[model samples]
Target: MPAVTVANPLALPRVPEPNPLTGTERPVVSVTTAPKGFEGEGFPVRRAFAGVDLRALDPFVHMDQMGEVEYAPGEPKGTPWHPHRGFETVTYMIDGEMAHSDSHGGGGLIGGGDTQWMTAGSGILHIETPPEHLVASGGLFHGIQLWVNLPRARKFAVPRYQDITSDRVALLSSADGGALVRVIAGEVGGHAGPGSTYTPITLVHATLAPGATLTLPWRPDFNALVYALGGAGTAGAERRPLRAGQLAVYGPGGALTVAADPKQDSRTTALDVFILGGEPIREPVAMYGPFVMNSRTELAQAFEDYQAGRLGSIPAAHAEVRAATPDAD
Candidate 1:
């Protein structure tokens, strides 16, 4: 829950209130609970985008809320080396540490409020795992991994990586000072985050004090979604109920609303929500396993290219290290 925090939210810049006369409040389209599943070497995850239509999540292929669970020593796990194409993987760590390494020479350690954005435009091979120290000591692990689809034009763009530390996030407050908003990518109320994206999108993590409400100006053309990370809240003008593990998809509008309940469980004192939206791509999507393409033919080509080792080769040094580790398999 400590992705980012401040002693006094009132000190931050306030998001301007939308003009009531012209602003239209979005209505909730549907609310769905995420189903729990295992991912990447058996780490528990909540499939956040499960049961949601791709049209509603345009430009976003998939999302997973990685463990809010505590891991005992030596129990941490992560993905094995894998190849991806025609999409970008955004890994945001709210707590604990994850070590990332790729065949394209991108690597880093991201923890607590940090983010690793990797674009597998054409293709790339990568792996993510808990750092050695973290696996040895055991700790809390909570994070999100979102897959963003690339338009056909940019599907073969150069591979790139961006390491966004917590300090780079744009922090803002509600007019009443009851909420803290962290802008990870895209713009919110004119404040922009550090991460650059191929598609027009906004990603925000907001924490609301009990009984607090936050209304944000939103782009009318972009789709909207609000996910409860912890505690309870209501979304949209219609006041659709939302709780941890739930997702609320919103219909067309110029503004969005989320309000925390008056009381919350002792374990989580405030309402935490992850808000995201993007312009619809509106193109045919043919996705399988790790590749997202516009057609089945392209997906087949991607697989053939991967088999030919065109994506990338594992760094010799890292390969040797992994082979020597007890858990390399």
Candidate 2:
């Protein structure tokens, strides 16, 4: 078993009593519920934060929480080969296993607690599916995939992938053993996640015990939001109670604070949430299903290129992600 270490409390920078910097006082602004949308063939998900203001949410546009649903024997479903352009897709697994296959011959399987980050720069075709082993036996599958919009200048960059395993992710803990945060990107407690982003962003998956509190600072220039995934908790200065399935879209502020409901039984209480935000890319965004570009003309070109197979294809042998059963695999 891989060892999970607790981060040193002194390693993490303490939040200033009042931000010493000018124009940087973190506050609780507006909180929005992430509307649910049945996106992939497999899960019931919610868009934790919603808005179209490109400047306010520059590098970020879409976020979705994949099913924490358990699939019965032979009932698992997933997304087939699809096309994407002008953005990056990040898949973080919480339970079960999911595999990634792409037209450029890039593929990887991230089991529970792992992450896979893919960039469909100019364009790429890919499929994310449950491994054959799980699909065959039928077990629980859960995960989250986030679509990060790219700046025009970098939209045409080459497609790539970053496979980050759970063992490589950094863990930050509170001095009292109350809060534990998994840093997927950005630094926490003097350590960082393995993701390499084109756009600077902060992404942390945190779990707090009953009454546990954790505060972290962010780039004052970036926008931020928090999505509750488990139990109940409060965020920002307002202390609004955010339970599971609630997404808090915060207004401009500096640092963010969150704590789990302390009154609950500590043994069973768990508050899970994802804190994410990034610098905005203020530019014209023309989006069609699966294609995002600066203008309608570019979007049209993307569709045409994909139809013409310009984006490439996944090898027949490696395209499908069949379950990796002991004997069959």
Task: Identify the leading candidate in terms of lDDT.
Answer: 1
Residue-level lDDT for 245 in candidate 2: 70
Give residue 62's lDDT in candidate 2 (0 to 100).
72
Backbone collision tally, model 2: 8
lDDT tens digits by residue: candidate 1, 63-156: 9999898999999988888888998999999989999889988888998999899999998888898999989999999999999999999999
Clashing pairs in 1: none
What is the Å distance of residue 250 in model 1 from its true position?
0.2
Candidate 2 off by > 4 Å: 1-25, 51-55, 263-268, 318-329
Report, for every candidate in turn, its global Cα lDDT versus the true structure: 0.90, 0.74
**Clash totals, every prediction:** 0, 8
lDDT per residue (tens digit) for residues 1-329 in model 2: 11233456446433333344633546766566767777656456776656434455567777778766778988877776778889998888887888777887778888877889888898887777778888899977667788888888899999998888888887766656577778888664346777899988888888777788867766677788788876788987679878777777667766677889876544336787888888888788887678778999997788788778788776788645432211110
Worst 10 residues of 2 by lDDT: 320-329
Residue 93 shift from truth in candidate 1, angstroms: 0.5
Output candidate 2 Cα RMSD.
Answer: 5.3
